[model samples]
Target: MKAFGSIALAAAVTLGLGGVVLAKPLSRIISETGLSPEDFEVLSATSDSMLASGTPRAGKEREWINESTGSKGTIRVLEVRDNCASLQHFIRPAGVSQTRQIRTRRCRDANGNWILTP
Candidate 1:
């Protein structure tokens, strides 16, 4: 009886562990940063706005906050190429403890819209 009980317990544990191993991967909640595709879009848009006229370059940095989510971060234009720009972005999601720093480059497409490259 003890041997049967032990076998049943072992099988239960093995099945539970197997299920865990096959579970779906964790979400990319932060979504952007670390050179992800999402990061490219977010940083490119912000850089384009910064390059627009009337957006002061006094401190070479801009702060943005999402009033709805309370998530905030900073964007800085590191360099501007003839047709492209490099940027540094720091993003912190609401309720997240760690902020992410990402660097990427954006260039003007034929239609004058900014796009990410490489």
Candidate 2:
């Protein structure tokens, strides 16, 4: 029956739209942490400057803050050997009471640029 087919199509359309509404954004899925893109930019810049300005050593640290979003964090060098360094990131997103810590590594390339590495 034409009416039955129409209803089925309408239901499918409604369910599809509902699924889209419930879908999480790609950025949110990528970063389970509450850090926004702006937050990551600020943190990256701080880490680069600290690691590139001079020879990095364990315990060297820097702090970054995004006043607009009220997100703040710290990047600390945990270890350094040769041209590579391991760092720890402490992030506190806005409106959050608990801080999240992440570990990462960077190595200076032949061009003397600090590059994030897995």
Candidate 3:
């Protein structure tokens, strides 16, 4: 009976780890960042809108907040060129003191859609 219980415990552990390993990459990232899906959505929309606006300029900053999750962030345009813009995101997860920052660049495609660029 003890051996059977050990086997069941091992199986449970394996299944739990397997589920974590199989989680979608984006979901894992969001979870790691301590941001809810709603918070991420708000951030994405705000960033895209800032980039899509005609003639983005450096020093422009936009803020986003998800009241449901209490997560907030700021997106600032760092640099702008003819077709590409680089921005910084300062993210503050709810109740967390350490803020996270992410820098990314986006360029306008021929069809006028913003695309993330390396």
Best by lDDT: 3
The lDDT per prediction is 0.51, 0.68, 0.69
- Expressed as tens digits, the lDDT of each residue in 19-99 for candidate 3 is 433424454656666776667667777876786668688999999998888999999999989788877778898989988
Expressed as tens digits, the lDDT of each residue in 1-118 for candidate 1 is 3333223322322233243323231222123222333333343345556766532333378777665566667887777767776666677766777886655455677877555543
Question: lDDT, candidate 3, residue 21?
Answer: 39
What TM-score, to 2 decimals, does candidate 1 have?
0.54
lDDT of 3: 0.69
Ten residues in a row with the worst lDDT in model 3? 5-14
Candidate 2 local lDDT, 1-118, one digit each (tens): 3333223322322233243334454364325667666666667678767976777989998999998789999888999988888878788989899987767677888988776654
| Best first by lDDT, ranked | 3, 2, 1
Of 2 and 3, the candidate ranking higher by lDDT: 3
Question: Candidate 3: TM-score?
Answer: 0.74
Error of 1 at 23 (Å): 20
